[model samples]
Target: MKSIAVKNIKGRPARSVILVVISMLLTFAIFGGTMVISSLDSGLSALENRLGADIMVVPFEATTQKKFDDIVLQNAPGYFYMDNARVQQVLEREGIAQASEQFFLASASASCCSVAVQIIGYDPETDFTITPWIKKSYSDSLGELDVVVGNDLNAFVGDTISFYGVDCKVAAKLDKTGTGFDTAVFTTKDTIKRLIQSSVDLGMNIFGKVDPENTVSCIMINAAAGFTPEEVVNDINLHVKNVKAIQSKELISGVSDSLGGVSGIIRVLICAVWILGVVILLLAFTMSVNERRKEFAVLRVAGAARSRLAGIVLGEALMICIIGSILGVLLGFAVILPFNGVIEQALGLPFLLPGAGRCAGYALASLLLCTLSGTLAAAVSALRISRIDTGVILRGDN
Candidate 1:
């Protein structure tokens, strides 16, 4: 019976190809859309956990042209300076529990590659934000000239990265954080100071005679018990001079909103494709069955049962769905896995693909859905073909 179904499909190559293409499109829509949505959702969650701060404080100039937002959310390389003393001032404000200062510098080319990345200098003793991830890979104190690279960076522990002729040894590499910051290079305040001095010596004019030791780039603060991040931010903005303070959520809101929009569009496209594919497939099967009425009647006269006729119709659909599903899934994997970075850059959102188990689940789910849609679309035609007036179709009677 299956062989007969296969023979029937091979008998008409064009119609079979069209049906297979429809099934392929259906599977591709489901798998591709779900993968994108899943990656964005997971990436945002990781960024939230990695931030671990209530408020961010930076020199008011960093807010100019949305420079700071670009630096934090998109990892666009730029830097501004504020007096390091502001860290203590912010920490002393009411509703502030703890604060740590960080310094920033931009390298046009990290020694290992020509890609630009941010160099962040954090206080080793007072920091809360960068420490959690750092401890996962390294526990020893970061010596001067020792640096920790983010997971997205090409450098590994034991590799040396140079900045403006200053070489810093990579002491550790932090795990993936699923944010643009993953490309940043982290180091002690002393190490970044050295890099700053090196750039100054090379006449790079990055600092313009500003004393590097007395300046830090930004501050990350945690609000005290019973104090919200909003309260802390407001207090700092009101009390501090020449610096801007903002709640952490404000920095992430843009990403959240973008993710929501992208995910919505993907889902809509998936639904639209699924509906259209089913309609086209149903029409194709019905028209093909109609064109083969006399062929079915001849087989019935040769002792084929009605159930056997229906099975052949469904079997052809099942074969198309299985082949199409395999092809679609392979195509999805080829594009999504290799080009995830390009997708992230294009969408301007961090993207971290789901783990192995989740990917397998999605693949299996899409395959099953494609198969169900195929068989169901053919069902109506199968029923009609099985119940035909074979005597009329065969005997040449009106």
Candidate 2:
């Protein structure tokens, strides 16, 4: 019976290929859509976790010169100075719990083709944001002039990278945070201040007249118990001088909404392709069944049972669906896994692929769902052919 089904599919080469393509489309949509949506979700969650702080305070000019999202969430290379005294001022505000200041400077444009990147300086003794990630890579306190590179940075542990003629040893490489933090470099406040001084000496001063001794680029703060982040943010904005205080959620809400919108569009597209594929496969199977009525009648006359005839039809569908589904999954892996970084840049969102086991599960689920749809599409045609009168079909009597 299986051999007969194979022969039938082999004989109608073009029709069989069309049906296979339909099944492939179905699987491809499912696989690709699931992966993209999952990656976006993971990235957003990681961004939120890595931030840790409930609020961010930056120089007012920093907000005007560049959006906060571009400066931190997008890792756009930039530097701005706010009086480091503002940190103490913000800490004095009501409802402020824990706070840490970070200094920022864009890396000098290398003589080579390298573009500028952000250099962030955090106070290790006072920081809660980056310490968690740093601990995962290196438990020891960072030595003077030692820096932790982001996961996506080219330099690795023990490698020395230079900024403004000030070379620093890479003590650790942070795990992927799936945020802009993945690309910027991290270091202690003292080291970053040294880099700032070196930049001034080298005539690459980005913050002209801004005293490195008294400057900080941003402040991260967590709200005290019984105080909401919004209330804390408002308190800081009202009390802190020359600074813009923003709730963390307000900063990331744009990104979260963008992810949601992208995910919804992909889901709609996946459903549209899936439904269209099933419809096309059904029509193709019906047409094929009608064309082969006489062939089936011949088999019926040769003592093939109705159940066997139906089995042959379903077997052909199963074979095409299985083959097509595998091809689709392989294609998805080739395109999505290798080009994920490009996708991330294009979408302007944090994107991290799900783990191997989860990806494998998605592939399997896609294959199963597509195959089921294909088989069901052929089932009605199979039943109709089996119920037709053998003699009438053979005699060309209808």
Candidate 3:
């Protein structure tokens, strides 16, 4: 009986083609939106993990006026060297957990094969953010005039490069972080000082290459468990005059803000697509229900209970929802497969394989929602058939 009902449902134009299209559209919109948001969030999470620093302490003058801009916009404007003693002072504070200092150096044609590479110099013993990841790849301790390159630095592991006339060995390659770290190289504080010493003839116009007397470009602070980043920033501001502390979230928000109108437009477009998909689905369900009233009324006359008639209608809707959702998922994956490189290039980040369990849950939940919505809409028309006078339905007056 169910087979005959399914076949009859399929034979009707409203149940066959339009229903499938609606399911395809609804699934595509929902899943596609999910993928895009997940991509953005994953990229952001990767970046935050790489930074690892809870608070960023830059020059006191730079923090008040757009913190990130002051640090990265132009080296000269953002450049202010706080006393290494002051860095230690912040460390000694009660709420402070740990701190590591780093300086950014930009090198052009550091080697014949590699182009410009940004170098971040850290004190190995004090630096905690990236050392763990780097140590995992290369067990050897980083030495003076030795460095590890980022995955996207356009150089390979074990390569050698000359920086400020000092030869440095590329000990290992860091993991792909999908952030600025991908374009940076890491080295020890001693190596950075030696490079600055070797570049005495450059006359102080360099982006990095600081004197040995100075400790670092910025101090990374990790607050104790009970302490909040904002409270620490406020404390630092009150006690320390020449240093600025920035929270990690503020830093990310700053970066997102710099993305300008493009991100906003993308969000708006995603919303519009969602609305259109829902409208298509509602229209498809309503039309299918309208065209099936006569058939449903006949089922009612043949001693089929109203519940049974409703079930047949709902079963057809479920079939359309399930088939359309599966096809949409497959199609969405196909679209994502070819665009891996494009996504990486556009975001300066690579995508991760979504968790199989999570994706399965998404698919199952989406189909359930779609099927339920269709069933409810069809149920209304089914109930209307139940309201018909039995004598009239028998007399073919549906």
Highest lDDT scorer: 2
Weakest ten-residue segment in model 2 by summed lDDT:
108-117
Better of 1 and 2 by lDDT: 2
TM-score winner, 2 or 3: 2
Global local distance difference test of model 3: 0.66
| TM-score of predicted structure 2 | 0.95
Candidate number achieving the greatest TM-score relative to the actual structure? 2
Which ranges in model 3 have alpha carbons more than 4 Å from their true place?
Answer: 5-15, 42-44, 61-95, 109-113, 135-140, 143-146, 149-178, 192-209, 212-215, 224-241, 253-279, 297-305, 336-357, 385-398
Given candidate 2, what's the lDDT at residue 201? Answer: 76
Q: What pairs collide in candidate 2?
A: none
1-398, model 2: which lDDT tens digit per residue? 44998998888899888887778878988999999999999999988887789999988878888456788676678888888577778878888788998999888676521336788999998999988878988999999999998888898899988888777999999987667888888899999999888788777876665567898988899999999999888887788778899888888899999999999999999999988999988998899888888888889999999998898899998999998899889889999999998998888898989999999999999999999999999998989987989987878744
The local lDDT score (0 to 100) that residue 231 gets in candidate 1 is 86
Q: Give one digit per residue, the lDDT tens place, for model 1 in 14-106.
A: 989988888888898899889989999988888777677988888887788556677866567888888867766777789878888888888
* Candidates' C-alpha lDDT: 0.85, 0.86, 0.66
Which tens-of-lDDT digit does each residue in 226-338 have in candidate 3? 99888888898788768777887787775555433444665677567656665666566556656656666667777878778766766776777677777777776777546
Off by over 4 Å in 2: 112-115
